[model samples]
Target: MVRWVRALVVGAALAGMITLAGVVLGRIYADPLLVRLVAGAAIGSVGLSVGMRRLPNWTVAPLSATVLGAYTIVGLKLAAGQADVTGPLSQIARDSLVNGIPRLLTAMIPVQPAPDTVVVPVIAAWLAGLAAAEVAVRARRVLLGLLPVVALYAGALYVVGPNASAAGWTTPAFAGLAIVALATSARPAHAEVPEVSAKLRGRAMAGAAAGLVAVIALGAAVGPWVGGQVSASPVDPRRYVQPPQVDSLDESPLNRISGWALSPEQRLFEVSPTGAKSRTVRLRLAVLPDYDGITWRVGATYRNAGRVLPQLPRLPDATTADVRQEIVIDGLTGRLLPVVPTPTEITGARIAFDAATGTLIRPEQLSTGLRYSVVSEVQTPDVNLLPAADVPSGNAVARFLAVGPGVPERIQRLADQLADGNGAAFDRATAIEEFLAEHYRKVADAPSGHAYPNLDFFLFGPRAQGGQVGTSEQFAASFALLARLTGLPSRVVVGFDAPAGGGAVTAGNAIAWPEVLFNDLGWVAFDPMPKSKNPRPVEEDFTPKPTKPPTPPSEPPTSADTSSSSAPPAALAAATDGGPGAAVIAGGASGSVVLLLAGLALALVVMRRGLSRRRLTVGTPDERIGGAWAELRDALRLSGRPLPAHLAATEAAAYAKEPSAVRIRRAAPASEAAPLPPLDELVAGINTVGFAPGAADDAQADRAGSQAVAYATALRARRSWWRRVWWSLHPGPLRWRRPL
Candidate 1:
């Protein structure tokens, strides 16, 4: 009865620890389903571990596996609504397994609790609970058992990364429960100790309690000081993980602006207000931020997403209206999904979303009759704050300030002339927009292209030289690049101006515009279209008489003369800013190679971890015993020391090795970590399992597997930190048939 009570406390503590660790996922994924899934997995694992404590070790592992699979299937079915689970079970399972971890890192947050996104967290919590309970309760190695729980908590922290800061109470709560579990666990019955007098025992207990109190008080005083010294931004793991690539992203939407203009009357799509009606809606299809002289492409990293898309931080002084619209595709093509600016929620279709760019894409092509619903938060900035608003600085927005090489010197001069005397970034942005609208002409059939040459001709080429007339494509691109050259941090957007009050959107409504990024206001739209008063409405076709281009005095408009004694050198520096020159591009290419190698290295680690998991968890009793020894051999090879293949199993312990400095807790030194529980016993078990058929049982197999992992961990820990890291990441053992 006493043992049963003790087991209950330990099991509850383990389950609670896993559950507390799982709260980190709640921040990453907003859905309440995560709560149910995590709690269910934690409780179920603990119950199974306690129930199976009396069973043979091999039988217990297989039973646990069976239960875990069933739990996952049920949890997934619940995540996908009952009506939505009409698809084949195999498809659901495949998607869950394939997208489980990959999408979690790349998906925008707060991620919806889709089956794929929830699977990883649920499984991790379950496994952690089961392992920790089994070790603490059955094996009676309380400290050793805490390792799995610690790993789960660390993983949760790592996966959440910089997305969310954990609550203040979480760490302290977990630590407190862990201490309780340790205090409550029953000691081994085989332990023998001399009896101590009551007085001495009380004194010893008092001294230990006083020491713990002193440690806690000291930590309370020093913790805040140490925390203040650390960096504000946490290390984000998403940087190392490559985002999903789609072939359709290669097709630039900016290139299609002119083509759409030629067929202006063709219906592209239609939008109907599902909620509050609005006077106008701007459905953004793509945001083109990257330009390499030839073309502007969408540089967003789109990841698989669910109904609730990630939203930007709301500005305190900004007024926002939620406009919900139901959109139906009529003649739209390609994979780009059009949504109103600053979409907060989406439904009616599966999509990949890029939060940074406020863009969405259907992995599959958009077909006629396809429909989706979107809820957008249209921001109304306080005009009072516009004049004083600043632009973001540092490496975060540096890409927006970068200009491709070979910008015409006249364009820079013109930008300077237009934006002269404007102290604020917003004022300069409006000045440029006002000048372009008043000075440029809009033509119905302007040719496509927004390259450096094209923009130069539009801004400075003589009228007779095919200059001064182009489509919205040229106007928007010119504005964006020119803004970059003036250090305003801008990007071009390719979208449609749907009819006022929401109706059919025709190709005629296809428009391009520039948006300037302000520190507090986000991306504020600017209209540089000819004859345009605001971002809405593409103007009707207009013809203009040819005008002579203005000629610069003394210099004859040379491209090399980007500087002048007139305006701020900052503007000229931006125009001539060799941001990412040839050498930088070369270094970027080199970095790509290094990333590819690192990805391959990570793949090897995953493959090896999977192999190790299967060897211990799958197969018959005899096969498991043999697998344990094979694991040890691989560990030996990875640790930079391998016994000869020809060496007999009995000779394993006798292998020569020098002592090392590192040690794993109270275990043997690095040299002695190779042999545990007597090498002779391990050798005899392996021989019996391999040759003496039917001689090994589940209990013996389980023992060998456990011993192997402990041995491997200790052996690896003995090396220097760098060598240990390399040992974990190295892939040489996978290709080698035998260790030397």
Candidate 2:
């Protein structure tokens, strides 16, 4: 009976190891690892139970376990509609095998597998378990039994390399545990049989264990470095990624933002703002008000900017210019055609407009060589003549003020701090604009992920701190987010920034800025990011107009500032001026790479911790106990000795066939963790919990859980500093798992 129990326990340990290894999918799947561990437990227990029964053929028990485990997983997913349960059995098999192939191929890892799609992995895992059980129990060979598990681990390693190290050693861990269980349980088929002495057997086990640990250590430490060396040099993936298709099947103007930011050589088009135009001109693509905390996108559909195209909103007493800008599209391809803000008329075939943004749209997919001319009525408002922002009666006002989800609380506070309480909206607007210009820096490159993930990282992520967020999009998005919190209507504008000589707009000139809406000035643009000086005028030509040679300054130019003979360098002076286009992008290319790498690392830590917590609280009574057990292993990995990959929990604890780190000192040298009676009790209580049919009870399960909590606290209290940092990334259960 004791031997059978030991075999079963080892089987369970193997299950755990494979499950942990399987968690590599967490990075790819949206669903958590808790869901997949179900299959791990089912496979392990079934194999062990059938084997312990002394079933007829060794293959019989393993094959039965494999079939049973596979069916159970498929049945569960089928019930969930992950796979089609309505289809004939053969058809379901065909779909799971055939249709699932491509999905598994292109599918990213650690991903949440689909109902039907996950079937393949589940079956693959079953086969692995079957092979493992046959070797370990029937053939009774440790290395061969571990082969299938090793294959799974190696495959996971090849797929993600070091990135999957968070759960890297599960296979060896369980296999060692299984070997110990079998060794301890062995009493020979015949009592008279003599075999290798106990010491030699022990030495063999030790050598095998040492080899496994060495293999894992090398792979974990050296694999990524090797992979990096062999692979192409690291480049920011976002640099190559096309613009985001903002919430539509068809591309929106915003979709091309990243491409524009990354490309400086390619020209999107040339804007001739031909006649009767202000010195400064900004082409409008989209005016977005709907911010779902991640992206800014237009919620409303297209309407005519005017009966014809490019019509500006009529403002009372506002000086309007009847201007014409001829735009010649280049390499850019999109359904949305770029236009200057407030065009009075646009001449083109198949052009539409969204008055919401004063943008022109081409319904068809864009092709090169597209041309359009716009006749616009632009409102040129000077600060002195413009009215102070006052209350406006417009539907647009409310939409602009609506704040999205992830606007950090600190940003809102900063906005309030900078804005004057008694001043009009314009005063607040100026203050905010100036605040961004002075406080926020601009970089030429765009950062990936949502603009602001961890505010601390964005605000103080780099060693440079204040200067890290230096990009037009960052400047514009941050300003818009803050302005909305300040009770002003704000949105981000993305469009081509025509060079000063208004001849052509290159991809480099694709810039973004904030536009705040006021009752007095409709969507007024604010340039918070610095850019190069535009020529005095973006006109047809700057050829020196025939000038009377040398009229010279009226008098020898007297020193403008007599007190200051030494002026600041051009770059330093420009940076200190605190205006849009004042500061050059700081290591814009490298900054993006740093941000991407940092974000990826942070995300991995967060997901690992969250999964650890979720695994503890979620599952059936047996499953919950299993979760707590897994959490204990995670905790031990930090505070206790670094678990050797080949050592099962008991072996690592320096014991045989005993689960849990019953004696912490064995795994942790000089360990001061107090004896946890509850831990021992919990381990003993769960001896039957879900290991076999009808082996669990409410009382046993509850006691085991309380003991787990007690043990966890005691174990974690004694961790070293480095371990404590690791522990932070493995958060505890703060909330009870909702019943699944």
Candidate 3:
């Protein structure tokens, strides 16, 4: 009973380690909490339970691991809406199982829960948990349990690489080590312990205290160096590049409101419009026109010469207000430089501009404390005089109005549901914008478990879907996607914002909104995220309504020409863009984790096999009797008697008086009842061979060894599942390694 409790306590500790690792790794990849917790708990409980056992250790470990791998693969496929059982699961096995251990060790930490992401963590956590249980419960080596827990953290660090905070995850692992110590200190026997005499045990307590401190100090000193040397990012970028990195941005649609609520009170950057602006102004970073059903991004990118931007593609009849804005970047993050819409010129030496997308970029990554000025003609169209595209035409129309597959028909139906089938572009856009304001609720962080592409969830999901609630990105993505379905050339724009009343901007100032293109008006912006009360009208910077606007800059590019110009780079024109661009590095000490587990598994097999063969197969005649006797005790355990501490082996023996008795039994299935052999005969032989060596009968000793092995094998075959579990936790050999 005490031993069983100790085993359970150790199992609990291992489960905690797995849970902690799962949560941390999941967060880095933006996996939903529910998903991580459920998966972690289910896998950890089973894995750790099996690990703490001593019976069937060889086959059990391998069998459990295979099941874990299969479960993860199948479950993920089901959740992803792929085929139920065979096709998708088989493909996953084919892709990942060939190099099973290798691929698992090499898998990347994807933000979304992809197949590799799900399988690798479950398999790794189970393996680690099993080791922790075995070390703590079976070996009764408390300190050794830390090995597997540490290895677990190390594997996570390698996979997560530099994506999240490393220091934050180590605290729980250290706690698990403490639990290991407590579990290991408990004796496995059921009997009560003799009271300790204080005087005699005085130095024992002190010595243990000192030893613990010394071990902790040693771990702390070594941990940093070892941890720093490991990495999980994919080493082969050319072969398997992570998507392009999105710095400090969680681009999920549900993040909309939190971004708005971003340290609004804390100024991240300062902006001063050269000319007093009419209202709050937004500093455009990049105009993303391509929607891959999930997110929006710039389709085409180009590097402009430092500071100088090419003239805005000549709009025919639109009024432009040149506003010079000086910006002092404080604490904000992103690679693209910020400028007000319609930038005519930028004053900086090391900046590059993408003329087609109107994006100002630094050759490398963005930095803090950046100060720059921009010359921009912020455009606002005359509502009455705005270009009328009853039937819009231009080369860029198809590209601007493009819709990716999987867009639900409900989105298109919503447009028709709200307005007449046809209306002027401006009127239709305004109606869509108003409809969004009226129906959707603006939520900063949506609950976990929202489906992927999340479009369906945003539009029609439950309450949390009592109303559509999401961040600006979702609103913009949905509105733009929906707007495009209605024949309005629409796209989503993401950038830094400078409101009229505020002098400084913060993370909350990072914003996204929808934009529509008119042949004569170029691209126009609008707001779709719902407001708390009376929603503010979308801002448009216009020189007071003008008559007969300036005309004839040039005819808008044709659809064919626009597609040719604004298309994404040929090298990266996939359905999904901006993933870690070769960022997951899978080499180094981190990459060697799989090799470690593999080596450990192999070494265990060889050790167990060699030990068994020596004890049961071959040895000197007398040695065989000792070996045979040892085998009989374990055989009883496998037979399910297990000889609980209160039961005496001598009293329980069916025959303790005879040395020449033969007690071999044939092999049978594990579920049936198998009789225990004549242990008295085996013990008598052991006494003769071990104490009165010269008097030993060689034939009797060999026969006992052979019969002992055969009976143990039969007992093993007839062992029940629970019996196997019981001995697996406290197998006799586990205690053979006396304390150093």
Reference-based lDDT, each prediction: 0.75, 0.55, 0.57
lDDT tens digits by residue: candidate 3, 437-474: 76667655643222224766676655533335666767
Error of 2 at 253 (Å): 4.3
Q: Give the C-alpha miss distance for residue 609 in model 3, angstroms.
A: 92
The true-versus-predicted C-alpha distance at residue 635 of model 2, in Å, is 49
> How far off is residue 425 in model 2, in Å?
1.4
* Model number with the top TM-score: 1
Worst 10 residues of 1 by lDDT: 535-544
Q: Please provide TM-scores, in order, for all candidate models, with all chains considered together.
A: 0.62, 0.37, 0.37
The model with the greater lDDT, 1 or 3, is 1
Compute the lDDT of residue 405 as modeled in candidate 1.
70
Off by over 4 Å in 1: 82-87, 188-234, 245-251, 274-279, 301-305, 315-318, 382-398, 416-435, 438-440, 460-466, 517-522, 532-740
| lDDT accuracy of residue 640 in candidate 2 | 25
lDDT accuracy of residue 691 in candidate 2: 47
Estimate the lDDT of model 3.
0.57
lDDT of 2: 0.55
- Against the correct fold, how does model 2 do in TM-score? 0.37
Worst 10 residues of 3 by lDDT: 655-664
